[model samples]
Structures are given as C-alpha cells and as structure tokens.
Target: MGDTGLKRHGRDRRPGGNDVARLAGVSQKTVSRVFNNEPNVTTDTRERVLAAAQQLGYRPNGAARALLTGRTYRLGVVALGTSHFGPSSLLVALERAARSINYALSIANSFEDDPSGLAEAVDNLLAQGVDAIILSEPVDDGEEPLVVDVPVLTLGAAPVVHAPTVLSVRAAEGGDAAAAATRHLLDLGHRTVHHIAGPQRWWAARERLENWRHTLVAAGADVPEAAEGDWTAARGYEIGKVLARDPGVTAIFAANDEMAIGAIHALHEAGRPVPGEVSVVGFDDIPVAAHVWPPLTTVSSDNAELASVGLNYLVDYLNQPDSPPAPPPKHVHNLVIRDSTAHPPATEKGDTRA
Candidate 1:
C-alpha cells in the first residue's frame, strides 16, 4: 500500500525521456536530441517532442545532460552584494537577461574589500560549472590578478583577470557623466564645484572623480579637494556637514543620488537653500531621485539595456567561439536636469569669497 494507494515498483516512476518519446510517437534518442538542441531533426518532430514533454511535466536531468554535452548552459554572476542602486539594479537586469536566453544564473557575492574575497567568490561560481562569468562592480584591491578559464564579461571597468576571452560593457561612462554635471554647474555661473566621491577602490568612483577634476582644470576653475563618502546617506550627511559650513561652496556634486539626498538634508539643516544659496547634483537617477525635495538633478543610464548587451555578447561568443571578436560599443550617459541646481546667489563670489 503506497501513500497514494498506488502500487510501488522496484524502480521509481517519474516523468522520463521514454515517457516523452512514447507520448510524442518518437524514439527516445529523438527526444534526447530535442532536449540537447541538436540539429537534423525535423521542425515538426522537435515541436511534438517539446509539447509532449510539457504535457507530461518532464524535465531533462540537467546534471546528466551536462555530463553528455560538456556544457552547463549556466551563467555565473559575481557582484558586490550591496543594496546600492547601481549594483542591485545591474544584478536584477542580469538575471532577467539570462532567463530570457534559457540560461540559469548562479549569483555569488563578495562582501569583503580584499582580492582574496573575490577570488573565493569566483571559485565558488566555478565549482558550480557555470559556462561563463559576469563580474559586476569590480574593484581594485592591489593584489595579483584573477585567472579564469571561461569567458568573462565585465559590467563596468575590466578587472585584472587572465582569461582567454574577456569582454567589457559599460552601462554609462562615469567620467563623461561627471564632466557633464560639472560643466552644467560652471555654465550656471558657479565658480567651482565641490565633489562628494564614492570609495576610491571602485573604478566607477575613480572615473567620476578624475573627470570632475579634469573638467574644472580645463575650464580654469579652482579645483577644491573632493570629500569621500562610502556610498551611503550617513556618510554623505557627515561629509555634507563640512561642505555646508563653507559659505563659499556654491555648487556640489555627490557621486550618487543617495549621497546627494543626504547632502540636501545637511544643507537644509544648515539653512542653506538648495539652488538658492547652493546647488546640488548627483549621479544615477534612481527611482526616488525625481521624488526627492526639489527633485534631484542627476546622471541617468539604462542599466537593463547595458545588461542585455553584455549578456548577449557572452552568449554569442559561447555559441561561436571561432568568430572574430567585435569591438565593444561605447555607451552615452544622460544628465537629467531638475530643480536642485541653479545659478549662484547674487552675493556669492568666486575665489575671493572662499
């Protein structure tokens, strides 16, 4: 007496390849060919086999299939594992892109800043037999380069990795965005712009900082020392206090929207009216950016589109390894103007005031 009042057999009876073959009126090998995506089978035959498998709720054994095909059909993602807008948004986009291509995603997070942490994370993904890897939000830790045997795709700047095939796709150039924001402020009559930068270890942060400095120098504006923030509102608030007190500081650009929001709070508390006495701008037009008081002026990029392009390149390379590699395309960043920035106040003066 089985639990369901059905007779138990020596061999467990679940949906299997032979069951699908019988339902589809095809041979078991034909069913295997369909599951493996092998060619030479007629289109009608493939359709019938798939329909039968669906009807019988039959799923191919992935482990057994991988053993036979020498490919796992799985993609691995290594991320910073933070709730920050950029990394989190890229992770979601990667998952969606992988699913759309019939590939499963194995995500691993590196919480520590050390290179060993990333190495360990990559090893974990490799152990799962991912066909390719996507490194998201890579940072420099001043350690030896990482080596991987499979194709590696980087979301932003390329990390030091010794792999046969390395591809990089950026959502938006951070340097360009920073330059645009800084120029916008200068055009609005701010003598110089104060910067609140993200951690220097991350490449994106360095790019933004470098461009901001370059833009000011090119325009012959006095480049003030940039304040560093740890990509958090709390850190932004702390740093913002210092800048808020400097009455000469007429314009500020925070690395990202969260920090910008924090700066605004600090300014309000210090009785400095945004866009009135002081102007503020930020990077990453996150969902809440437009809803914040005075509506944040920030740099916006299409993270999902970037993810799709990177994933498609990886898939294409995997499918056609012998094809000549195509040069990566350039991405443009857009600046969204809002209520947070304006010309300097009438009483404000440039180097003379500070």
Candidate 2:
C-alpha cells in the first residue's frame, strides 16, 4: 500500500490483494472476502480494507474473480431505449439493485422501430457471458421470440423471449393500476370515462388499455373508443385536441403522467376547466404530476422494488435453472388523489362537488 510494497512489486507490477491485506492489517483471505462481498466481515473491517485498497490504487481483478466464481455475476438487460419516465426509472433501479449485491450490469436498448433488436441483444449478452438476461420495458417488437442457452428474466410482462433456462419473474405492470385509476373516475359519478392508452404492441401498454376497458365494462359504463398514443406528450396533446372537442368526454384516464399533462394543457387551451368538466387521471405518478397547476391524480408502482425483486429471481434461476417460474413477488399499487379529479359537472340530477 506504501512505496515499500510498490518498490517490492516493482514499477511494472500492479497492486493486488496482498498489498491491500498488508496495509489493512487483515489476512489475504479477508481481503478476498471483502472484495468478493462475502459475509463474516465486520463494517469497520470492510471500510478499512476498501480504504487501504483505494490508497494503493488497487482494483479487483475482474477476470480472476470470474474464473474463481465460475460466474460472471453480471445481469444483462434489453430495455426500451426511451426517455419515458417509467422505463428510465426502472433502468436506474436495476443499476442500483445490481450494485447492492456487488454484481455488474450491462444494458442493451431496443427502439420501437427495431423489431429485430431483441434477438441481436440476446446474442450480444450471451457473447458477454452474463449469468442471466433481463427483458425490461416492453416495446412493440415484431421479432419472433428469442431462444437462448442461459436463464432469462422478464419484467412487467410475459417472456418475450424463450430460453432453455427461464425464470420469467413477472414484474408488476398496469392491470391493477389501470383498474384502480378507472374505478376512481367511475366512483366520482362519471357515467363513462375516456381513455388515452399507450401503443398496443407493448405488453404494459396493452395491459393498461385492456384493464381500463374491462373496468368500464364491469361497472356497466359506456365504453368510448380509446385514443392510442406513443408514450409522448406531443402525441397526447394531439389526441387531447380531439377528445376536448366532445362534450361527452367527462372523465379521462391517460396511460402515463406525460400524456395526462399534455391532455391537461390541451384542455386548458380549449377553454375546458379540469375537474369542473373533464376530470383527468394518469399513471406512473411522475415528479411533475404533483407540481402541475391542477395536481395530477395518478397510479404509482415501486420500480426500485420491482428491479430488486427481478434480480433476486434471476439469482434464483442461476442457482436452480430448472425450477418452474416462481410466483410473482407481491406488488402494491398506490393511487394518489389530488385536485385534478372530481365529480362530474352538475346536470339535472344534482351537483356533486369535490
């Protein structure tokens, strides 16, 4: 860790575990334990070991660790490459969760236009020798399901790909959330609710639309034709202009916060007072939802918990690749009611205020 060890290892040699162990006054095995993130090391010992390693400019030998563990400890993800809040949040959650267990993450992105992107991404992860592959943030991909040799885990949807070893831990998606949002509108005395749904190809999008429709049907409410959107505010605004033209549209459920915000803007421009006439609900409870002029009421799921649970399932699959797909982790959906939603406007029946 000091100039002595540096001189001993020679100028050309790299600092390794021994130097860190000597500097930290711990055994070589302890240094290995600390770097490998195994249990039995105290907090002080771990910090001392890390500090010593840092001072010596020592980095763990990735190749050596892989050889010793017989696993790369890497989880590769094929995620939808967009700035959409939901997907972006899930990606960040996955990174944080992976690091907590001392694992590495590799991500491949597939755009909506790239149908064959998933296949190529699977091959790329396989080539990288990842322990498992995760399919996150489903998109409208037309490519045939992929088949790979390693374990595969998919979040928020079905197994878009097939693998000999498949975990397929279902991540919580839209069904419950959509139903909650739709029911919230119905409970407010809106005879019928309109929907602004995300594109149908993605499983998450389809789930939200299907659930919203089912909820309306279950309530014996009028089911209006839904407007499909591209998960973009611009698209939401475009669709909103059309919906705003109809006086019959008393309540609206947008698939995401961005769309809801866009719809709100369009409604305002059209001289429509939100909640006074058209009550709006959105999904994903994004940060801006609360700050908007009329605080948006929306549904939220824990992306961080979803990501952590998905990785743990992947780990289980790695340990037992042949086990049947496990029951989905328990997920909770929260509906935050705010000023944006209220009872429908007074008619001959009676006026019901917020």
Going through the candidates in order, what is the number of backbone clashes in each?
0, 1
Q: lDDT tens string, model 1, 124-180?
A: 999999998899887775668888988898876656898889988754444378899
Candidate 2 lDDT, 1-354, residue by residue in tens: 455357644455678888898899999999988776665799999999998987888888778888987888788988877889998999999999988766899998877677777778778888899988888876755646678887777776654566766555442455488998999999998888899999887788898898899999999998999999987889888988999999888899999989998999899889888978889999998988999979999998788888888787677556544567667565567899999999888763455544
* Per-candidate RMSD, Å: 5.7, 3.6
Clashing pairs in 2: 156-171
lDDT of 1 at 312: 78
Query: Candidate 1, 155: how far from true, in Å?
Result: 1.0
Error of 2 at 18 (Å): 6.4
How well does candidate 1 score on lDDT at residue 189?
A: 86
Count clashing pairs, candidate 1: 0
